[model samples]
Target: MTDARATPPPAEQRLHPWSWLFVLLQQLRQFVVPLLVLLFAGRRGDAGDFAEWAPLVGVGVLVMVAVLQYFTYRYRIGDDGISIRSGLLQRTQREIPFARIHNVALHQTLLHRIFGVAEVRLEAAGGQKPEAQMRVLGLAQALALERRVRHRGTAAAAGGGAEAASPAGDTLLALSTAEVVRLGLVSNRGMIVFAAAFGLLWQAFPERAAADWLQGFFREAMGYAGTLHLGWIGMAAAATATVGVFLALLRLLSVALALSQYHGFRLSEQRRRLTVERGLFARLRTSVPPRRIQAWFLQETLLHRWLGRRSLRIDTATGGREDDPRKLRELAPIAPPEACDRLIAHLLTEAAWPPPRWTPVPRRCWWRLFAGGVPWNLLLTTALAWNFGPWGLLALLWLPWSAYAAWRQAGRLGYAMDARLVAVRGGWWSRWWRLAEIDKLQALRLRRSPLDRWLGTASLWLDTAGAGAMSPPLCIRFLPQAQARALYAQLGRMLAARRLRW
Candidate 1:
């Protein structure tokens, strides 16, 4: 063992003093809505005549509170570790060694951008919340700190500066502006429903102005034609849907514009690590090493399939903010088939994820999709229609929808297992490639419905624990009993090999 006295620690770097702007900004976000209500509502004599003076007093008090909170915030980075001192009523000090830092993220909301500040979130592998945060910091200082921490952290992880790669030499992958455009376009389809819902709610409650909770619900409902008249509702719903689709297209346009600024975005690889640096208005850099990855998946939606594209997702041991900082890495959209192959090869050991050893789903499963679901749904629809008149006919639509969905999954559902990998693909138009080392699986459950038992079929659901309360679940429906057991045994063996870390 080495002696602690043998080595001297390096000096510490104090973050920019302007970081207080972040605390101020955070206070603003939390207090603004209530403040606005107090001010405007009081203006109309809602709080009584004395309420007129309350806004001024309230504003002054709020400002003072914000200042005090900001004054109490501070962070320090030493050669050995990073220290953060924060919290308002209760003071908490957190120290994280450079070696344990998995990723660092810089985030700026519209408010932060206006103030020329950003938030720095430091993510560790095991914790749910960020290890620590310099809540508010000058944008420039935040970027500089990110560079410093990433370089130092990578150096520590590699054992010393001697093995640390240059910051510029570490990029592993990047998305071109064109590629970002493609990715954005494919995402447009999903946002249509969201936009339509918003529009319908706003349209419903014309009396209630935007941003009120009750008003928002009424507005979205009406905007989507939740109620009004049947003919008018249909027309409104159609119009709302159309508007939603268009807005989704516009969203993609904005993303494309943003990507153009980083047209030549690049990612560089060094040793077992990967780095991603991109964005124009606000730059971002994230780091992850291959060994820390829990899983890597490829998502190909109907739009992606039509466009011949795919999104890559890498799940890692790190967790904190929702962003990808804690992730192993998410590549820009790539060709579906190729992206699937590349991810599987990179994240899994050679012996674990060879070419898929796929087994076709049993034929009986197809009948379940057709006979079991559609008939019941259709029966419910017909009964509703019989009682409610022509309005009930809408329920009949279920038959067609279910028929289509089942038809799609019937030929598509499949499962494959190898020494190191398990892949399940089931979806009519959307194909998901979920790849994980057998050792990474947190739990395996074999379930059988009464129908499944009678049919000698079972469902296998796999999960990997993450910081989030709910980790993503991969469910394979209707595999043969024998096959499910075989897969379960294989997973158990792999987990045991790793001492059941799951």
Candidate 2:
């Protein structure tokens, strides 16, 4: 291997010739709402040229910034690392070693493909932003860099780097059209899309709140239904049918979105690194090492179970704290339960799927959970009764409903710790499993809340150095205090002597 210390500065390279255009569009997108607000608001008032000139000025500024960025940005790929230098007045330079760069993400909009270019982002741990981002680069150049980082870890000496780049790797999984449909049915992306569209609409008409518009529409619908002179039962049926139709349309939209988002989905492995490539018009391709994956998640909802499928995701060190739509955290968006099991087993040989023993929490904890929710149930009932008179007493039904749910959940709440992995399972209708390798753990602690202390119980909290920041934590809750302490100490011992692969 070449010595990095003695190496000279590598040749500096520029981005694609039309990089400025992409950068301009990206900048324009961020200010589109404000620009439109200014333009249209001006039109409504007495501002003559200001309306047209305001947007022009904003676009002009953005165009200059993008052009400046394109001209100033420079990068160098060396044997051991990559160096980047950019900025005009506030210049900054960064040197990122391959060992420190954990993920290489590439994206391509339809325009990018038309120009034979892609956007590149190099993500490392502990940073809120990507380590280095190239707005536009020749597709071939981006692929070469991805390969360089892929085999930089344990396989450097094995000639694994010489074989082929990202696309040539072995595909472990590929989603068919039917699977995409299943994924759509299981996902709530339609809601997210609707929310986004609603937000845009609100921004477009700042004075007209979405709530007001929706309320007006609902009132109109109610009046129209009353004009039908149908009986109460018929009206109820009509309302139910309307809701059902709306839900059906939402599901259909979700299906179309899933198909477009994951049209050519594939999960491949190269050396010890995993790569996911997906999207239709706008493509997203990302690669991260297995060692960077600190946690694994398996989700099976009521719908997923009925469909005979499940979802698998991983929390990787390279994942950013905030949700980035381009993030490829899903190992399997929707797959058969057996397929998910095999994939997990293959990806995590040490985890030992279906752990030999799943130790359930104290059975009596069910009462603790059931009683704990009583206050909220009572509060909800009281509010409803105050508003709706005696009929609101029906709200008390939630008490028993919640009690049964708590009982079932308490029964299913369990944890398993083997030599190499620790897994926690929770949830009732929407079940989940969070698994983390012992060696990958960053910290472990025994927690005791006031109520827990009063009840002589404690919780075992496990933390790892990766993403899943928004995911439910991996914790074994409501165990006897002493048992929790023992597990904490055992995990602490395991963590102390272990060596992190990444």
Candidate 3:
């Protein structure tokens, strides 16, 4: 081994004193809900007594534990990587090598921001959690540590010792306040927030009260509508207006959230890694190497299309944790289509941009789409017929409209592949163009269901690391069996020839 590799790690370093505050805050957040439940739901005097003293005792214990943890937790940086030692009763020590470090992220929560400290998280491949993390360090210290880890990893990959200098690349993209606001306008964050609030309320309040309130609210609404004595057409128009108003309010909320979370978003490239710095009150710095990127998704919703805007997101191999705010995968939240295309070209210079002619999926896929929706629509029509007489047939009109929509969606399904990248384009309400590098593909699967077999069609699925629970795998459905087989073979050969990167 070289002298650098043989060098022992330096003495252990303790976190900043502010880390105790952060730890205390984390524990409080974890216990707050349960404590509130205990306080509010306690019916007996003994229960109330327990709730009162339990929090005090629990808090005291937590403070003692946090203080102990602050003293016990220690980390050391070595030529190879980092080592962490923690725990009170049961000691735990972990050593991570630079070669295995996939990402080094920096984050500043409200407390960290106030104290000018940052949290450093070191991620490794194939691990569900961060390999090593330091809760509190001076901002400069955090940045230096991140730089050192990344430099060591890169140099090791190139079969060399650490370089004296780091390569600084130009900024690739930055979001303006206006653009961030637009992102909020196009985001569904408002719906998400509203749903979360509703769930919390449902959980906290008695079910009887919630059900009664909902029933009363709907009854009053129906009563008011009955007083209008309007025709069916008028009723339809009123319902549409109400829905439109609700959507407008939701969009406003979404914009407000976007403004707060992505106030000064910026993306830059350094060497082969992409760095993202964003957030308002709680800043986050995330770095992702190109090799760790699994796929790129270019999304354009109907609203985005109307505004001539698009958004770019990526999936990286670095897994996500609920407590970490630095794992966000958005590249460009909102930008013009051309700008997004340019950014993608800059990021993946090896891959061709504005891909060649897309091969359309078989037209027979429309039947598949239509058949998939048959059961749901049929049930709706039946319910309407049971409720109303001849007027119920109006629901049948949805059948033809739904079929036409399926046909239109089938027209949008297309795929294109080159030597470096494979691109798939599809989506009905929200158009998406997904791209994946050939060398990054982990697996490829061709599936044929009974219906697909009868129609002589198949579906192709591509798996890559870094996909989230909600993110779907890259897939193209309803392709001709012969074409699917050929493409499958072609991808298999490409995957075999290229070495896996992530």
Candidate 4:
């Protein structure tokens, strides 16, 4: 009776023209190393001459693919959701409902910036990859789409209403240039970069060449000091000074990199969503819904504590993987202790500060924790004794310090939970305080190792979806079995009473 052909087609849209170049560049980056390897691998003379043309051929093929992709890809945004049609030979279509959209992230690369376009990524809960993405869109168009999605998502969650109101809050926190510098100083980014660079160099070049280069540089420096006729003690001091200077330079480089990445970092909250904008070149704009946040961590390194500063990071459920840089997990990379407190208070209105009581781990657990370090100390002592004879016996001195450190850690280890929030505090030298909403908890694990069983104790782990595999869940270790059970039951009751927002 009714012909489907009579129905009007959904409005379709294409990505910015610059997206062709973006896609081409991405393909080249992905294939560059393999192409280079094929071109250079054991090739000589004529073979190398042919290889030289290979790159151009590869580029031509990539350009053709990019152009084809651009022509074939199309997306439709309608009242209910978004639908995408893509691929050339093996065509594929994907439809995403507004209710399933988790977060929309906007990113700009150097190329995008030059062309005044942005990349938009759509993340969905429990997804291993972005649900959908547009390589390039006009900046205004991307923002409008993001706002529309957010409005639709909010309305859908609220059981239908007028479009959600526009973001309605002032800037909560803004980082100054000085604070950005502090972030660099407090971060170990330089060491990470240097280590990565060294690893790549070692892998690419001959091991002997790399080793010789490092040895030669150090030997030349030492030889110059030798000309000063310094005694053995003085030579040792010089070496130490050199190492210290090198470390300082590394730290400086780390700081510089931080400065470049987070040059104009700004954090603002509006309509229960947090916005973070940062980056010197490849600018990023991230929006985080309050319900999506799984937990918050307040971290203070020894250096940070000395400077009376702290950093705030949040774990969100929408992040794809640990290595995703676009996640925008840091709330405050560097801030004054007082400012951090204010931000925490603003975000978690239900949680009280200076919590009414902190239940410390049993003092008896100190020896249990301390004894765990004994084997490592013994190993060190054995190595010293083997290499330095009786002088190595001095390594035994570490036992007392280790014991004291363990004692301090046991004293510091504590947990507090209320109807709405659960807080865990621990750390040896650098302190970390983790807070999570009771409703956000997804699972609970209880375990007792052989030694723990002997000690009549158990450990409780509170699991949340926000934590990555490498990031341990909230753990309360060395608690009496009875107490652990009691706390677990209490938490279960709290979790049952509240509906999970994420």
**Estimated TM-score for each candidate:** 0.75, 0.91, 0.89, 0.91
- Per-residue lDDT tens digits for candidate 1, residues 366-408, read 7677777766777887898889988988887777777777777
Deviation of model 1 at 305, angstroms: 2.4
For model 3, give the 10-residue run with minimal summed lDDT: 156-165
Best by lDDT: 2
Error of 3 at 129 (Å): 1.4
lDDT score, residue 242, model 2? 89
lDDT of 2: 0.85
Position 10, candidate 4: lDDT: 55
lDDT of 3 by residue, 1-502 (tens): 5787664647888988888878888888898877666656654446657766776777888888888889999987777877889998999998888777777788887778889898888886555688877878777677767777767744432211233223356688899988988899889999999999999999889999999999999999989999999889998999999999999999999988898789899888776678888888888888877678888889999989988899998887886563356775788889999999998898778989889689899776787788888888778888888899777778889889889888888889999989998988887877888888888898999999997888788999988876534344588778889999999999999999889978
Number of clashes found in candidate 2: 0
lDDT of 4: 0.82
Minimal lDDT window, size 10, model 1 = 157-166
User: What's the distance in Å from true for residue 393, model 1?
Assistant: 3.9
Better of 1 and 4 by lDDT: 4
User: Candidate 4: deviation at residue 490, Å?
Assistant: 1.3
TM-score of 4: 0.91
lDDT of 2 by residue, 1-502 (tens): 9887884656899999899999999888899989999889988888788786898899999999998998999998777788899999999999889889888999999999899889999899876788888999878777777877776633322222334333477888899989999889888889889889977888877555767888899999889988999889999999899889988888888999999899889999978888999998899999888878888899999999999999998888874655796666888888898888898889888668978899999877887778887888788888989999998899888887888888898989999988888999988979999998888888777889899889899998888886447467888999998899888888888777888654
